[model samples]
Structures are given as structure tokens and as C-alpha cells.
Target: MSEYSQNLRASYEAVWGTYQQFTERNEALLRDILVEGEDYYAIEARTKDLDSFEAKVDLPEKEQKYKDIAEVTDLSGLRIICYLDEDATRVCEQLGELYDIDQEHSVNKNEQLDPDQFGYRSRHFVVAFPADRAALKENARFVGLRAEIQVRTILQHAWAAIDWKLRYKNSAEVPQHLRRRVFRVSALLELADDEFSSLSVSVAHLRDEYERKVDAGDLSIAIDRESIDIFIEKDVDLEALVALAEDIGYSIAPNHPNARDPYGGVISTASLAGMSTIDEVRTKIAEVVAKKEPRLRQVFEAWREPDRPPRLVVSKAGLARLAIVLSVEVPQAVALVEKLPFGPKLQSALLDVLRNG
Candidate 1:
């Protein structure tokens, strides 16, 4: 290695640990922001090692020479891979709020692309801890160290990873005959990313509308996962069944394994009982609770472990399933139990209880 490069490597080795510490702290801060309810693919942090630092400094595209290791912005790097493009944008805004961004150096590669050009797109931010944060003793070592944070959606990340493997950094770099194929694949991924983001917004809107309708006692909304969630939250009849179980000396456990997909269980129970609408499901539940509370209690008891105490505890979905069983024929009720989230051994025991009674 050249003397200049060797000196730079020694300087890097001296501060590489500090860069690692900086990225670690910054990653924690970023994770705190994400835990506010954003879903992400990953949050990764790294301090460039001597080899990577040397290669980066030697890249032909670098506009100027780095006289010192500190001049490299990406000695510490962190990446936030999100599930949607909109999530990437939101995270970038949040990052700006938490860090002092070098606006002149950072770029949104999506906006930088020309109308005809295709390349991997990401939001690259050159940032350091804000003054208020850096002023603290614990953060003093990171006062002048800047890191590059890249925010990109999963699809954007996929394209970049494969594109790197292809050794074509840009559409223009591909052979002329293959350029069209490369651009087409890149465009498809970009379009899929956009469609995914749009579909997420649409789903959120639909769920909100479902909540509004279900709250208003509009049972005409057909039964589905989102609608059923709202129904379970608001339906008085389901609440009554839960209360009935409690009054019968049984605890209604909402956190049971059967509650893993309470909506799916509800849907299956309703379907098996020939109920179509949320209205029908609620009507049947009310009817069963009104006339067959005794039978429902018996069914709940049948679910108890023979080796355990006499008092019974049932999942919310389990109680719902029992109610549905009373509303349907014996054969259909057995079928519903067979589909229960319970394991096969308990299912067999429950079947014996049902058959004997």
C-alpha cells in the first residue's frame, strides 16, 4: 500500500472502535423511533474496516481525495430497510428530526434519476448527532463523526442487491442488447413497490371504514378478518357470552392459543353453522345465550382437563365455538371442534365428551 493509504489505514484503526460505538448508539435511537409502530425489514449498523475504508477511498467516482479518515462520511453506516416506499420516506423525515443532516451531501436517488434512466433508489442521509445530544458526555465522542444512513423499501433493497451482483451499477452500464431487459426488470420491481404502498393505504382506509361501520352497529358488512376484528371489539352479544362464561364460574382467556386467529375461528364457526353475515352470527349468539346458557356452560366444562380441577377456563374463541355448537347440529359442531386450534389429543378427548353427552 502507498504511504498515504497506510497512514490513513492506521488512523482508521484508531477510531474504528469509536465509529462502531457511534453506529451502535445511532441504531438504538433509530430503533426507538421505529418502535413507535413502524414495521421494518431490518436495522443494520457497521463501522467500515480497514479494507472497506481503503476501497471506498480508492473508488474512481470519488470527487476528491480524503486527506484524513474522518473526512469519509460513511466510516459508520446504518441501513433501515422498510416494507413500503412510504415507510422509507416517513423514516427519513423522522431521522432528520433526530440528527443534524448534511443536506448538501445527502440525496434521494429516486429524485436524482432522469426520466429515462433506471437505477437502485434509496434515501441517503449524511448525519451526525444533533448538538443537544452531542453536548452530553456520553455522546461527546460522536460529536464530529458523521454516518450515512440509507433508507429503502424491501423491493428497492432487492433490486440494489441483485443489480450489484449483475455488476451493472446503472442501466447505462449494461450491454446495449441487454439494457432493455435490465430496465424492464428494474421497472417492474419499482412498480411493484409503488403498488404495495398504494395497497397498504387502501387496506388501512378499508379497515378504518370497517371500524366505523361496525361501531355504528352496521352488521351488513360481510364477515372478514378486519370486519370480524371490529365486530369482536364492539358486538354486545359476544360480550354477553363472555359474561355468561364468567357467571358460570369459568374464566374467559383472551390470550389463549385459539385466540391466535380469533377472527378466523369466528369465521369458521359461523360458516360451519350456516351463518352468513355478522348480523346472523350475532343473532345466533344471542339466541343460543338466551335459551341454552346451561348447555353452553356444559360444553365449556367438557373442555376441561380430566386431570385438573373442576373449575373451567376457556378462550374467547373457545366460548364462541361452544355457542356456535349449540346453534348447529351435532355433526357440524363436531366438525368445528375438529378444526379447533387445540391439538389432536385434546380434540379426541373433547370428541369423547361430546359423543357421551
Candidate 2:
């Protein structure tokens, strides 16, 4: 209604126009780098008119300092809400790469605050338009002026919006009772974030386990023992056999013979025996143990021999003896077998003792 109010609205429109162009360019760039399954959401930008901008000018000194207050926009600005906390970090990192950041702060109060003060969390960055940007001169009012970028997980954003509406009549007057209630709400939000993070971790672990099993070739042992039986009947190299099984969706373990976690697969081995390829190592280990009936008992007995010790020991003669027994050439055998789950060094040492004896 006032002349100053009209001028401020016009300036805000100009700033908003620049913000639109900047966000559009940045959002396209973001789409390219985000992972396939990850969620990408909207980007919003706004500029304040006189009424909103003047609302913050509480002090007499502040009012006197800016007589042409209508021209000064951006009292409150941009926000990005991501589906997950991880995504918030990703978006912030991407934003940093694109924008000329003025200031950056993270309010993860849940982590640093006392139990009493726990609540919503977000990452905020103030960014100015790049000097070289074509629109910089046209939008000179927003050139040196910084726009706030608030990045928060979806849940945090929800709490923030609700708090913004309900918590204060004005930013300056947050009564004590409402402040206490806000802290309690913040605690609940933190708990929600923690639960989501835990769920994400659990899902990731399960995915890793499934992938390992699929790679190792033991998925069928429990459901279709016949698959293992057939592979053994064909004398397939254990590792290759597992690869084949994995291609068919069967789970398998890694090559290490003494692997404590069967699904973890073998990382290294002691004997450096029959294994010549990764697949051969894994498959052979699985073949040696899959039946777990007569053959496992026999192999265990042989491995437990006072001289053999059911572990691979690394030594020249021991290695050579294993190479001879497994009928594999020394180098390939060593490479693949060394990846067994048990202590390859110990296995090789025992093998040397057996050869000498």
C-alpha cells in the first residue's frame, strides 16, 4: 500500500527471478551425480518483500541504519529438503561445488547439545552468486547479497516448518514454556533420525551379506544340496563352481577353509594348495565342506592330523608339498590358496613340519 512497500515487492521479484535461474542450472547438474536409487527432490527459492523484511528490523538503530529498507530483500531465503540425512550431505557437497559459499554451519544439536536441548538438525550455507555469472550485474542488488541455503532431512524440515509456524508470534519473543515444548519435540525428531539411520545400516549390512553369498556360491546348499553334489561330481574347481552357482542365484562362501563366518567368504588362506583362481579357491573350499556329512568328517580328520593341523602354513617346502598334493602349479596355487579364511602362514608352517617329518 505504501510507496516503500511497493518498491520492496518489485526488488524481491527481481531477486526471485535470479534465484530461479541459479537453482534451475544447479538442479540439472545435481541429477547427473545422484545415485540411481536415491531420491532427488525439489529446490525452492524466495525473497522477502518490505513487510517481511521490515519485520526483522526491531532495534531503533537497525531502523535508522537503513532508510531505504524496501530495497533490501532476502530476509528469509532458499531451502533444500532431502529424503535422508545422507542425501542432505550429498546435496550440500554438490551445492558447495556449484556456488560461491559465504558461510557454512551445521546445527546437529542432537549430537552436541545436552540431553535437555536435543531436537531438529540441519546444515545451512549462505552463498553469493559467482562473480563471473552473467546475471550477476543485472541482479546487482543480489550480487554481494548472500542467500541462505538450508539443507535438512525431510523429518527435520517437517519439524522446522511446524516450529516456525507455532513456536513464536515474533522471532524476538519465544516464551519459556513454548521453548521447553520445542526442545521436547526436537528430542523426538532426533530419535526418529537415529532409528532411520539404524535401519539404513541394517539394510546395507544385509545387502553386503547377500552379495557375498551370491559371489561365494553356497546359496543352494541349504535348499538344494543337489547343486553342490552335482558340482562336486563334475570335479569343478571350487571357485569356478561357485561363480556358476552365483550366476544362477545360489549363495556361496569364500575360499578360506577356516572361515568363521561362512557367508563372509575367504579373504586369505594358509595352504596355497589346490586353488588357482578366486573362483577355484571359493568353490573348492565350499566343495570340501558343503556335504558336511561323510566328506566333511573325512576332510576334517585329515586336516586335524598332528602334522596337518587343518590350517595352511606357508613355507617353501610346505608350499611345494601342497602344490604337489593338490596337483596345481606353485604360483597359481599360492595366489588363490593364500586368500583362504584361515591363517595361511600357520598352514604353510605345519605343512613344512609334515614334509620334514
Candidate 3:
């Protein structure tokens, strides 16, 4: 080993601990930031290993221009893998806000590709603790050290991995005949990424529109995951049934294990019952509230005991589903009881009330 190489290795080794700590701290911060917003795929970090560091320094003498190890901005690396392109962009913006970005070295790989070319697409940020943070006693050690943050959608990350395996950094590097085919594959992935982003935005807009319509009493907006949620939140009949059940000591546990898909379960039950619009759901629930209200209490009492609580706990959404099932005729209601999300004991208690009524 050359004296210069040994010295460079030692320099990296001396700060490797601090770099490791930096990645851990920053990774945690990134997780907290991302958690406050939409869901993300993953956040990962690593300190460049000794061999990888050596490989960079051992590049041909002409290419080995780093006289100081600090020039290597990626000695510590972090990756934020998101589900959508807009999420990746949002992460990049958050990174910029949280750290001092070295704008000169940082690059958006998406922009680097011309319209006609595509291979790798990610947002790379060379970042370090900002002046204010670095001035803090605990952050002083991370003052001068920088880390590379790579933000990419899962699709882009997959493409990058496949591109790495193919050993082609870009379309320009491939043989002329093969370049066209590679570009085609790359174009397809880019299109899929854009489509996914578009679908995500559309879903968000639709959810907003559904909530607005449901809040405005527009039950004609068809039943769906979003509408079902807003409908349950605002539905008076559903609330009334839940109040009746609660009056009988039946608890509404929104976070229970069985409550995971209360909204989705209603969608399924509503489908089987042939209720397509929120208005239909409301009317059916109101029917149960008016006529079958006593039967609903009977089902609740069947599950309760003299000195004990009810064996099965149902959520408000569950109450809506129960009402919908009981609204149908006895034979159909009995058949649909199995479709509702309940354990055997509770379903049996519910079935008894439906059939014996």
C-alpha cells in the first residue's frame, strides 16, 4: 500500500464512527419526517466500507484526483425509497430543508436524462448538517462531514438495480443495435412511473371530492372506500344504531384487530346486499333503526351476560354493517350474517337473532 493510500484509509477510519452515527441520526430524522406525511417504502443508510473506499482511491492515477478524503461526499450514504414519484420529490424537498445541500455536487438524475434517453432516475443530494445544527454541542462532530441522500420511487430503484446488473449506466453506452431495445425498456419503466404518480394524484383528488360530496349530503356519489369512510363519519342513522348498541354496553373499538377493515368490510357487505349508493346505505340503515331497532338490541343482549360485557366488540362501521344485514328479509339477512366480519361465537349470536326473530 502506498503511504498516501494508507493515510487516506486512516483518515476515513478515524471518522467512520462519526459517519456511522451520522447515518443513524439522519435516518431516524428522515423516518420521523416521512412518518408525519404519507407512507414510504423504506429508509436505509450505510457507511462506505473500507474496500469500497479503497476502490475509489485506487482508480487510475489520472482519475484519482482526490488529494483529500473529504472530497468524497458519499462516504456516508442514505437512501429513501418511496412508492410514488411525487413522494420522492417531496422527500428531496424535505432533505433540502433539513440539511445544507451541496448544490454543485448534487444532481437530479431524472433531469440528467434527455427526453430521448432514460436509464437511471433519482434525486441525489449531497448534504451536511446546517450551520445552526452544527453549532449545537452534540452536532459539532458532524459539522464538516457530508452524506449522499438518494431519493427514488420503488420503480426507479428497481430500474437502477436492473441497470446496474446490466452494467449499463445509460443508453449511450450500449451498442447501437441494443441501445434502441434498452431505451424501449427504460421508456416503459419511466412511463409506468409517471402513470403511477398520476394514479396516486387522481386517487387523492377523488378522495377529496368524495369527502366533499359526502359532507355536502351528495349520497349519489356511489359507494367506495373513500365515500364509505366519509359516509360512516357523517351518517346519522349509523350513529343512532351505534348509540343504541352502546347503550346496551356494546363497545365501539376502532383500533381492535377485527376493526382493521371496518370501512372495507362495509363495502363488501354493501355489495352483497345490492346497496350501491351512499343514499341506499343510509335508507337501509334508517329502516333498521326504525323497525329492526329492537332486533338489533336483542342481538346485542344475546351476546351480553348478567354481570359480564359482550363477548364480541363491534366498531361503528361494524354497527352499520350489522344494520344493513338486518334490514334485508330474515332469510337473506341470515345468509349474509356469515359475510360480516365476526368470530364464530358472535356470528352465531347474530344468526340466532336473525333466524329466531
The C-alpha TM-scores of every prediction are 0.88, 0.47, 0.88
List CA RMSD, all candidates. 3.0, 17.2, 2.9
Provide the lowest-lDDT 10-residue window in model 1.
Answer: 254-263
lDDT of 2 by residue, 1-357 (tens): 444445545655655555555554444444565442364455565555445554445444454444553323234466777777777777778776766876533244335544443344677676666766537555454455555667777788778777667754332455676776666666678778778878888767765654455456544322122222233333334444334333433333333544333222222232334233333433444443353223222222334556643342232222222323333333554444444423454355434433432
**Per-residue error (Å), model 3, residue 10:** 1.7
For candidate 2, the lDDT comes to 0.48
The candidate with the higher TM-score, 1 or 2, is 1
Q: Candidate 2: misplaced stretches above 4 Å?
A: 1-41, 54-76, 104-118, 131-145, 168-184, 220-357
User: Which 10 residues in a row give candidate 2 its minimum summed lDDT?
Assistant: 312-321
Ranked by lDDT, the better of candidates 1 and 2 is: 1
Q: How far does residue 238 in candidate 1 sit from its true spot (Å)?
A: 1.6
Candidate 1 ranges beyond 4 A from true positions: 60-64, 248-262, 305-319, 344-349
Tens digits of lDDT, candidate 3, 1-357: 556666788888888888889888888878887862364688879999887887778767724477788898998899988888888877787787899999999999878987655768998999998998789898888888889999998889998899888888756678988988898888899899999989988888998998887778778978887788778778888888777777766788774643445587778888889888989999998887776478877887777667755445877777888888878888777767775656666687788887777
Top of the candidates by TM-score: 3
lDDT of 2 at 342: 31
Q: Which ranking of candidates, highest lDDT first? A: 3, 1, 2
TM-score of 3: 0.88
